[model samples]
Target chain A: METLERLLLGHPFFTDLDPAIGRILVGCARNLRFAPGEFLFRENEPANEFFLVREGNVALELHVPGRPPLVIGTLGAGEIVGASWLVPPYRWNFDARAVAATRAFGIDAACLRDKCEADHHLGYEMMKRLLPVMVGRMQAARQQLLDVYGHPGT
Target chain B: MNASVAPDPMLPQPWRVQAVRRETADVVSLDLVPLAGAPMPFKPGQFNMLYAFGIGEVPVSLSGDPADASRFVHTVRAVGAVSGAIAAATPGTVLGLRGPFGSAWPVAAAAGHDILIIAGGLGLAPLRPAIYHVLANSERFGRIAVLYGSRGPAELLFHDELARWRGRLDMEVEITVDHADPSWHGRVGVVPGLIDKVAFDPKNTVALVCGPEVMIRFTVAGLRAAGVADDHVHVSMERNMKCAVGLCGHCQFGPDFVCKDGAVLAYDRIAARLAAREI
Candidate 1:
């Protein structure tokens, strides 16, 4: 628990936080593990939760008809997964699959949202911090799609 | 009433072209000597707008060492009339110079953090200074990694410098090309594709990216996908500018001015604008 607390504090999403707030964030998190080839979440699913990777790898898979599940990008330990929960629609844009056996700390989206609403500072910090991460991820996905693999007949 | 336009002290001091090195078929490096007594002072990642006699001016990054502020080095590719003229200038020719403008790469802040640089084509030119700054202050940083991509082997800039960077134990350099001929034996792919091959603790890493708008957009994504924070990712932008100052709206990216606000900005700072096709 102490080690997890340290890891949480170390993450950019929580780095600027006070230890008390960091502890509160850690307390709200639930640890989970997924084996390789397991589904963490599917595309278009209601995004009720977000995960911070602790170990192993996960691939953000985009499925197109008559095409393979293209690996748009991968995320590893210390990174946040499922950022769509921050904005409206609260639905995933891509499927997330475990590329290797993985461990992550899951935060209930509803609960976090409730806490954020109750404490605007927490809300401000989280959004202020996570917004860029979301944009960066979206831009990266777009880039991958525009890369050689994204181009037809490459 | 008209406000007087004061000469910007940050502008490059008048300099004479000392020599030119054909780094590759397309890229040429110019060594400039100050016309006066001393060389211009410029930080890494800042650029100088070079003016050819009758031609126009173009922003070119300073590729030389920041530690030695006297002699300035510029690496250029012939992409436009002004660029071609500047590249074609013979040794000892005089060229009008303005600016070592824009904020530099945050080498001081980057101290103790693992540094990752991703550059594409001419984008590598701006980032070359940051690479030199880090290498000169080698002990101040953790592992340093640079990933550069170009159209092909013939277009790769700083071949000798790339070789030297590859040889350093403290540094990691990766080169990729969009297309490769028979002579090309290295990795062949977009620069973003190479992000996964390097290992850096995103929690302790800061990434600097400069390249084409498309490449910069993708590289930021790659860094984030690799777990790097948006705030930790810094990017240098390329936009058309008639004036390097903010008064000219040509280089606008959203509410921010790429010329004054930044040619270099944190990924998070411009993330929203970057997501849009046009702004």
Candidate 2:
């Protein structure tokens, strides 16, 4: 069985994280798994945790009143899901469902937020890594809006 | 794939349409057989100037199997007047065609290395022939992966063929759409996002990319980030090709004529021109 410390240590997301910070993350992290088609989180729910996917895939979906949920994006093994935990209000913007049987590390958002509030060094380090992921997602969303494959001026 | 130039590059040979298969709402693939002499030999990335008799001529990529000598195939999206006429043609409709012009995908040069094919939207049409060649000679390459993306589920080209390729254990095929309804169980993201999802030795890999210019730009960046050299990356440039032989300057990008020097060229050769908006 992989211990929380070992798992957090091995993840790419913690590659350059300070040793103390890794230990702090391990304290807030716990193993999480979801069966195929199981919902990990829903839109408008309090974002209490974020996931570092260790295996399988997760689909981020948007629900419509009269239609089935539209899948906006997916996160696979080695990718992280849910940045909403970092912002104020901390509310999920989309529903995340496991596309396959998935294993991940769920890190408690409130626990980490409290620690960051106490330590500026940890907060800065986390911000450096988290900002890129948020920026990348934003850029991808912008590109999707361009509809490069569709007819021009659409 | 062979690349012998035609004797009269400007003269249009009549090719009778054997069948027309609609791939999408506005996209159609025309299967054509020669009305006179033997089928014109062409390479994977070469194109034909299809004339709609009374309409006009448009440069369309050859989208059929390079080994299939019975007929020529061109997948066209009804984007303009010339293409709309070409796409609307029925079986037995005879269309005029010029030489199999432009450079070809570097399948020969890429032997012994992993092959990465990235396509966006109808860009798959031009890369289809090269895909046929590579898969046919799979033993020559180390690993083969094809990453394709479209605006949505309905915009993807070569549906049946994509499934067939995905079934092969020797190759990897990953398809994504920019958007999808609930019915879609596959990926939903830009094509470049899939680059990191696949396995390839960047140092010993050759990448062939075809798509809208913006998509190509992003795909190139992803390849470079994965350690693939600029020279090892090739992109097909679509331009306003008036004279398929390069006499007209309509297809000129910087100093190279797309019809003559490319449709396919190494990324290093045109990195500056691709970044320039005026060019």
The TM-score leader among the candidates is 2
Q: Give the TM-score (vs. native) of candidate 2.
A: 0.96
Span of 10 residues, lowest total lDDT, candidate 1 chain B: B1-10
Candidate 2 CAPRI level: high
lDDT of 2 by residue, B148-223 (tens): 9999899999999999999999999999999987677788999889998889999999999999999999999889
Cα misplacement distance, residue B85 of candidate 2 (Å): 1.5
Off by over 4 Å in 2: A16-20
lDDT of 2 by residue, A1-154 (tens): 2477887878777776777788777888899999999988999999999899999889999999888888899888888999889898999999999998999999999999998899889988988888877887888888888889988645
Q: Please compute DockQ, using alpha carbons, for every candidate against the native two-chain complex.
A: 0.03, 0.80
Q: How large is the interface RMSD of each prediction?
A: 9.2, 1.1
Per-candidate clash tally: 2, 0
